[model samples]
Target: MTSKNRDLRHLHEFDAERLITLGRAVIETETAAIAALAPRIDAEFARACRFLLNCQGRTVVLGMGKSGHIGGKIAATLASTGTPAFFVHPGEASHGDLGMITPDDVVLALSNSGETDEIVALLPVIKRLGVPLIAMTGKPRSTLAQAADVSLDISVDKEACPLGLAPTSSTTATLAMGDAVAIALLEAREFSAEDFALSHPGGTLGRRLLLHVSNIMHTGDEMPVVTETTTLREALLEMTRKGLGTTAVVDADNRVAGVFTDGDLRRTLDAGIDVRSAPIAEVMTRQCKTTRAEALAVEALSLMEDHKINALLVVDDQQKLIGVLNMHDLLRSGVV
Candidate 1:
C-alpha cells in the first residue's frame, strides 16, 4: 500500500493507540498526584479538619460541572462517615440555595482553576454569614484559594486530553484530596459506626451496624416455649413450629428457666433417655446464655463468637423470652 493509503486505512488503530496513551497518562498523573499528597499533609489540613469538626451546623459542599459531580460524591462520603454535609450547586446557591448556609456551617468548595464563576460568586455571601471557607483548588494563587481559611492544592501537571481541555487528572487529584480531608477528619473525631448509622439508617450499613436484636428477633407469640412439665414430644413440636432449632422452658411464672436445643436432644438420646416417659426439663440447659432484645447486632456477633453458638434466646429483664436470634439472621443481615 502507498504511504497516504496506509495512513488513512489504519486510522482506527492510531486512534486506539492514542486512547490507550491518554488513559495511561491519566493513571500515571493521578498516581503521582496522590503520592505528592503525602508531603502536602500539613497544618492547613489540620486546620480544615478542626474547622469542619468544630462546625456546629452542616457542611455545604460547592463546585461546578465536573468539580460539582466530584463535590456531590464528597458530600455523600462526608455525610456517611460522620460529618454532617450536603452538596449545593454553585449556580443554585446564588439563586436561592444560599439560605442553606448558616453562620455555624462550613463551606468546602472545589475548583480546578479556582475561578469558576458560579462558585466564586457565592464566596462573598458565605463570608457574610461568617462561615469558614475551605477551598480545594489546583491554582493555589487564585481568588478562591486566597479567600479560603484553608487551601488544599490539587494541581496536576497536565490533562490526559490531547488538547488539555477535558478535566482528567486535575479532577481526579481534587477528588482524592477531598476524600483525604474527609477521612482524616473522620478518624480524628473517632467517629463510630453507630454515629454513622444515624446519618444513613436507610442503607445497608445502617441495617448491619444499627439494627439491634430486638428489631428483627422473633417476638411475642412467635417465640418457641415449653413448660417444665411439657413432654419431649411437645417440646419437639414447638421447636419444629418455631423453626428456631430450640425451645425455651418456663416456670409457672412464664420465666425463661432453661433452654432445650437439638444438640441437647441428641445427647439425651445418646444416653438412652426415654423421650416418651421423660420430661422436657430433663434435657434442658439451665442458665442458658441469653441476650437483651435491645442489644446491638454487633454485640450479638461477639456473643455468638465467644460462645461458638449459632443462636441465642432474647429475654427481657424478667427473664421472659421475648425474641430469638440465630447465626443465619446475623449472616443474612450482614451483621456477622
Candidate 2:
C-alpha cells in the first residue's frame, strides 16, 4: 500500500468513536425514513396486497441499477415467504424477457424517480398485455407512476450519503416496504414454519424444523446402554465402547430406568465407591428427560439447553429405549 493510504488506514483505526458516530447517524436517518412510511401505508398498500393475492400467475419485479439489486432481493424474499415472484431486469424485458409476463401476472416495477426509461418504455406493452401494474417510486406523478394501475409511494426524506447520491435510506426503505408486503401476504395465506422449511431445505431453518430425533439419533447397537443390574465399571465400559460419554440404565423390561454419565462416575470416585462392584442403578440419575423419535431435532436441542444436559434417550410410546443422542450428535447434524 502507498504511504498515504497506510496513514489514512491507521487514522481510521484510531478514530473509532468518529466511525461509530457516523454509522449511528446513518442508521438513525434511515430508521426515521422507514418510520415515515407507516402513515402512508393506507388504501394503496392494501390494494397492492390485493393485487398480489389475486394474481393467478407470478409477481414480476422490474427495476434499473440499485433498484434492480433491491428488486432481486425483494423477489427472493417474497418467493421464499410463499408469494410466487421473480425479478426481471427492465432492460432485459425489452430485449425479449417481456414474454415472461402473462396477463394473469402482477407487475411490480421499482424506480426511485418513477421515470426509468426502460421501464417507462415498456409501459404500453405491459398495459396492452392486460397485466396489473403496481409502481413503487419516490415520485408519484412520474411517467411510470402515471401509467401504473396502482402506485405505492416509496419516497424518503434524504439520502444517508452527504452527497445525496448513493441509494442508502431509499434502498433501506424499499427493502423494508418489500418485507412488510411479504409478511402481510404470508399472514394472509397462513403460511406455516413447515412451509418455510420446504422452501429452504438446505438452510439452518430446514434442519431445525424438518429434521427429527430419528433422523440424527444413534440407534440399535450404537446405543450406550446397560441394565440396572450392571456394575458402574460395566456401564463405564459401555460408554467408552459407544464414545458418547453416557449410558442409559434400563430395567429388565428394556425400559429406560435412569442415565449414568461421566459426571456420575466423578461423584462415584469422590465417594471412594467400589465402581467394579457397585450397581449402576444406585448412582444413575432416575429423573432423565427423554424425547420421542418423531420430535423435531430443534425441540431436542431446546430440551438439552433448558436442562443444561448434553445427551438424551429416545424412547417409544411404551417408554422403552429406542435410540440415543448427544450434543455432539446434534452439532454434527447442524441442529445445535
Candidate 3:
C-alpha cells in the first residue's frame, strides 16, 4: 500500500467505542451551548425582534467565513417563517452589494469576535444610512456590538472542537438564537399555516394546504355517474368507462342518491343478485361519504381514510352531483 493509504488505515484503527464517545461529547457540548442561550433571550432579543418586525424593507444579514454559513440559514428561517430577510456576503457587500441596503432595511450582522474586518468596515456606512443595526456576537463589548442598536450575546464557554480553533459550539448557539428571534417575530405577525404555505408553494405542506377538491376532482363527462334507476350492469359499465372503480348514483334532478362501487358489486354477486336486472339503487350505498368542491384535498383524503373508502362524491349544498374524486386522483395529484 502507498504511504497515504497506510496512514489513512492507521488513523481509522480506533475502536468503535472511542468514536462513539467522541461523537457524544461533541453533541453534549453543542447542546449545552444552545441551552446557555435561553437566559440571554432577554430585553435585547425582544428589541431585535422589534427592529425586524417594524422594518419597512427586508432584513439584510451580513457575515464572514463560518458565520456566513450560519447567517444564510438564519436568513432562510426568517424569510420562511414570516420575516422578510436575505443574506448578503460581507466581502461582496463592500464591492457593490452595499447599495442593496437602504434606510428602510434593518442590518443583522453575525461574527464570533464581532470584529470581522469586512463587517466592521461597513459599520460607518450602515450607521450613516440611519437604519437599525442588530449584532449577534460572542463579545458584548466588541466594536460591532457597541455600534449596534441591539446586541445579542451568543457567547459559548468553549467550542466542541478539540483543537478549539474550528467553530462548533458558537455557531450552534448563534443558530438557536436566530431561530428564537424568527419565531418571536412570526408569532407577533400572527403568521398562519396558510400564509407559510403561500411562501412555500412548491413544498409538500403547500400541496396539502392549498390544493382543493375542485382542482383535482374529475368533472362532467369524466365523472362516473348513473341514475339510481339504472341497472347494475349499466353502472358497472360507467365505472369501467371512467376507470374510477366507483360510480355516483343520482336521481332525476341530478342529486346524489347513493354510490355504487366495486366492493358493492362483489356483495351483490355474493348475494346471488343478477347484475343485468338488479336496479343500481338496491345495491348502492345509501349513506356514503362525500365532500364539497371547495374542501381541501387533504381533508378529502382524511375523510376517505376514516371511512375506509377509496372514492368520494363531490356535491353542492343541494346534494347535486358536481364532481367525483378517487384515491388514484389524489395519488396522482401528489396530495396523498
Candidate 4:
C-alpha cells in the first residue's frame, strides 16, 4: 500500500475511493447551501437591509464560539464598507457587555443550534431595549428564532463533518448570508468608493482613492526654484538646498520656463560645459511634464509612469508654479 493510503486507513479506516467520495460530499453540501440562499434573498433580506440602513446607531453583531469569530469578521466588513458596526461577545453580553448595545442599534445574532445558552441569555436584554434583532440560525423554530424580529434560516441539510458535530457547512452559510446583508445595505446607502477609502486610510486602497497631489507635493520654500536667467551654478545651489534633485527654471513672472534636474546636470557635466556661468534655461528641459495641484496623486503616478521620470512640477491654470512632487513623495504617501 502507498504511504498516503496507509495513513488514511489508520485514522479513517477507509479506502482511497471512500475518502474521495467524502471530500466530494463536503464540497457539494456547501455549494448547495450557497445556491439555496440565492432564492431566499427576496423579502426578508430586503427587510433586514432596510432595518440596518435606517439604524440610528451602530450595528451590534453577537454570537457564541465559532459563530462569534465569524461575527467579528462580518462586523469589520460592515464598518469598512459604509455602515458603522462592532461585535460583542454573547457570553460577555449577559454579564455587562450588553451596555455596549443601545436602543437605536440593530442586533445581528448568530447561533447554529438556535439555543446556544450564551446567545439565549442576551435575548431578554435585546427585547427590553427593543433593539431590532436579526437571528441567523440553522433551526428557525428554536428559541432564538421565535424571539428575533427577523429570522434568517441558514439551515443546511447536513454538516460536512461525518460525525455531524463540527460547525462547518452551517457557519459558511451564515457568513455568506451576513455578507449578503451588508452588501445589500451598502448598495441602498449609495456609499461611494471615497467614503470606503476614508475608513481604510491605512491601506493601499486608501492611498489610491483618498490621496490627492496637493497632499504630497512640496510647496513654499521647500521647492527648488531659480530664475530662467540664473546660472547653472545658482540652479545647482537651489537643488542642493531643497535636496529634491531638481530645480525649476522660472521666467520673470515666476511661471515655469523649463526644468533642470540631476539628470540634466549629469549630462551637462559629461559635456564639460561651463557650469559656473551657463544660464540654466539653456540646458534645462523646456518640455518637462507637469501636473495640476488638484489632480489625484494616482494621476501624478500615471504621468510619471508614462513619461519614465521621477519628479514633476505642480502648476496652476495660468502656468504659475505651486509645488514640486517626486517619487519619494509618492512612496511616503503610499501612492506608489
Candidate 5:
C-alpha cells in the first residue's frame, strides 16, 4: 500500500469507543443548548412573530457565514409555513442587493456576535428605509440588537466544538428558535395543510391533496363498462380489452347498477355457472363502491383500501357512470 493509505488505515485503528463517545458528547451538548432556548421564547419571541405575521411584504433574512446557512433554512421554513420570507447574504446587501428591501418589508438579521461587519454596515440604510428590524443574536447588548425594533436571544452556554471555535450548539439553538418563530406564526395564521400543499405542488403531499379523481380516472371509450343485461362472457371481454380487471354494469339510462370483476368470474366458475349464457347482473357485485370525479384521488384510495377492492367506478350525482379507476391508476398517478 501507498504511504498515504498506510496513514489512513492507522487513523482508522483508533478506538471505536472513543469515536462514539465523542459523537455522543456533541449530540448531548447541542441537545442541551436547544433545550435552554425553550425558556427564552418569551414576550420578545411573540413580538417577533407578530412583526413577521403582520408584515405587508416579505421577510428579508440577512446573515453571514454559518449563520447565513441557518438563516436560509429558517427562511424556507417560514415561506412554506405561510410567512413570505427569503434569505439575503449580508455581503451581497452591501453590493446593491439592498435594493431588494423595501419600507414595507421586515428585516431579520442573524449574527452570533451581533457585530458581523457586513450586517452592521447595512444598519444605517435599513433604518433610513424605516423597515422594522428583528435581530437574532447571542449578544443582546451588541450593536445589531440595540438598533433592532425587537431582539431575540440565541445564546448558548458553550460551543459543542471541543476547541470552542466552530459553530455547533449556537447554530442548533438558532435553528430551533427560528422554527419556534415560524411555527408560532403558522398557528397564529391558522395555516392549513391545503394551504401548504399549494406551495409544494410537486411534492407527494401536494399530489395526494391537489389531484382529483377526474385527473387520473379513465373516461370515454377507455372506461370498461357493460349494460346490466350484458352476458357474463361480454363483460369478461370488456374487462380484458380495458385491462382494468373489472367492468361497470350500468342500467338502460347509463346509470351505474353494479360491477363485475375478475373475482366474480372466479366465483362463478367455482359455482359451476355457465359464462356463455349467464347474465352479468346475476354474478355482479351489487352496491359496489364508487366515487365522484370531483373528489380527491386520495379519497378514492381510502375507499378502495377500506372496502378491500382494487377498482372503483366514478358516477355523477344521478349515479350515472362517468369514469372508472383502479388501483393501478392510482399507483401510476402517485396517489397510492
Candidate 6:
C-alpha cells in the first residue's frame, strides 16, 4: 500500500469515541488558555495599547517559527483595524531586512520562549534606534521581555498537544491577545465604520456601506411613471415597457399619488373593473412605500424586508418622483 493508504488505515484504528475525546481535550485546553488571558489584560496590556496608539510610524511585528505565523496574522488584523502594522521575519531581519525598521516605528516581537536567537539579536539595535519594543512572550523573565519597553505576558498553563511539545494552547492565547490589543486600539481611536470600510473596499461591508441608492436606481425614462388620470391599460403598458412589475401614479404636481402593481391588476380584474377604460387612481393602492435617492442600498434592503416588498419608488424631500429600485438592482450591484 502507498504511504497515504497506510496513514488512512492508521487513522481508521481510532473510532468515533476516541476521536471525539481527543478533539474535545484540545478544544477544552485552548478554551481555558483563552479564558485565562482575560485576567491578564492588566496595566501592561493598557501600556501596549498606548504605545501602539502613539506610534507615528507603522507597528513592525517580529517573530520566529510558529510565532512568526501568528505574528503575521496579528499584523494584518492591526493594519485592517486602523493601526498601521506589518510583519517581518526575525531570520530575515538578521539577513539585512532590518533596514525596514525606522526610529519612528514600534517593534512588537513574539517568541513563546522569549529566547529565539534571531529575535534576541535584534534587541540591542532596536534599543539603539530608540524604537519602543512591546514583547508578547510566555516567559516574562526571558531576554526578549527584559529588552522590551512594554511586556504583555502570554503565558499558558499547558499545551493542547498530547506530548506538550507543539505550540497549541500558547499560540491560541497569543493570537487572542493580539486581537484584544488591536481592538482596544481601534476603539480608542473611535474608528468609524466608514473609515473601516475605506480600508476594506473589496469586502462585503465595503460594498454595503459605500454603495448608495443613487448609484443603482433606475432613473428618468427607465422609471415606470404615469399620471393618476391615466387609464389602467396605459399604466399596465408603462409597467410592461419599464419591466419593473409596477408603475407609480402621479397627481397634478407630478408627485407620487399611488402605485399600480401586478397584484392591483389581479384584484381589479377579479372585481370586474374595466382595465381598458378605468382611471388608475380608482383601483391603485395609495400610500405606497418609497425611499430617498441618497440613502444606502442596504437601508433600502431593510425597508424591503421590513415591509415585505420587492421594489420601492425613489423620491425627493418634496415627495417628487425621482427613480426606482428593486431587489434586482441590489443584487446586480453586489450590495445584497
Write model 5 residue lDDT over 1-336, tens digit each, in one string: 999999999988878898899999999999999998987889999899888988999999999999999999999999999999999998989998999998889999999999999999999999999999999999999999999999999999999999999999999999999999999999999999999999999999999999999999999999999998899998999999999999999999999999998888899999999999999999999989999999999999999999999999999999999999999999999987
Candidate 1 lDDT: 0.87
The alpha-carbon lDDT assigned to residue 145 of candidate 1 equals 99
TM-scores, all models, native as reference: 0.80, 0.91, 0.98, 0.84, 0.96, 0.95
lDDT of 6 by residue, 1-336 (tens): 999999999999999999999999999999999999998899999999999999999999998989999999999999999999999999989889999999899999999999999999999889999999999999999999999999988999999998999999999999999999999999999988988999988989998998899999999989999998899999999999999898999888979898988888889999999989999989999989999988999999999999887889999988999999988999988888
Runs in model 4 deviating more than 4 A are 1-29, 233-237, 262-278
Model 1 TM-score (2 dp): 0.80
Best by TM-score: 3
lDDT of 2 by residue, 30-86 (tens): 999999999978999999999999999999999999999999999999999999999
Q: Which 10-residue span in candidate 5 carries the lowest summed lDDT?
A: 10-19
Clashing pairs in 1: none
Clashes per candidate, residues 3 or more apart or on different chains: 0, 0, 0, 0, 0, 0
**In candidate 3, what are the lDDT values of residues 207-306, reduced to their tens digit?**
9999999999999899999998899988998999999999999999999999999899899999999999999989999999989999999999999999
Candidate 2's TM-score reads 0.91
Tens-place lDDT per residue, model 4, 1-336, is 999988887878777898899899999988888788888787887888888988999999998888999999999999988899999998888789999988899999999899999889888878999999998998989999999988888898888788988888888998999899888888888888888889988889888988899998999989999998899998899899999999888889889998999899999999999999998978999999999988999999999999889899999998899999999999888888
Deviation from truth (RMSD, Å), model 1: 4.2
Clashing pairs in 4: none
lDDT of each: 0.87, 0.94, 0.95, 0.90, 0.95, 0.93
Clashing pairs in 3: none
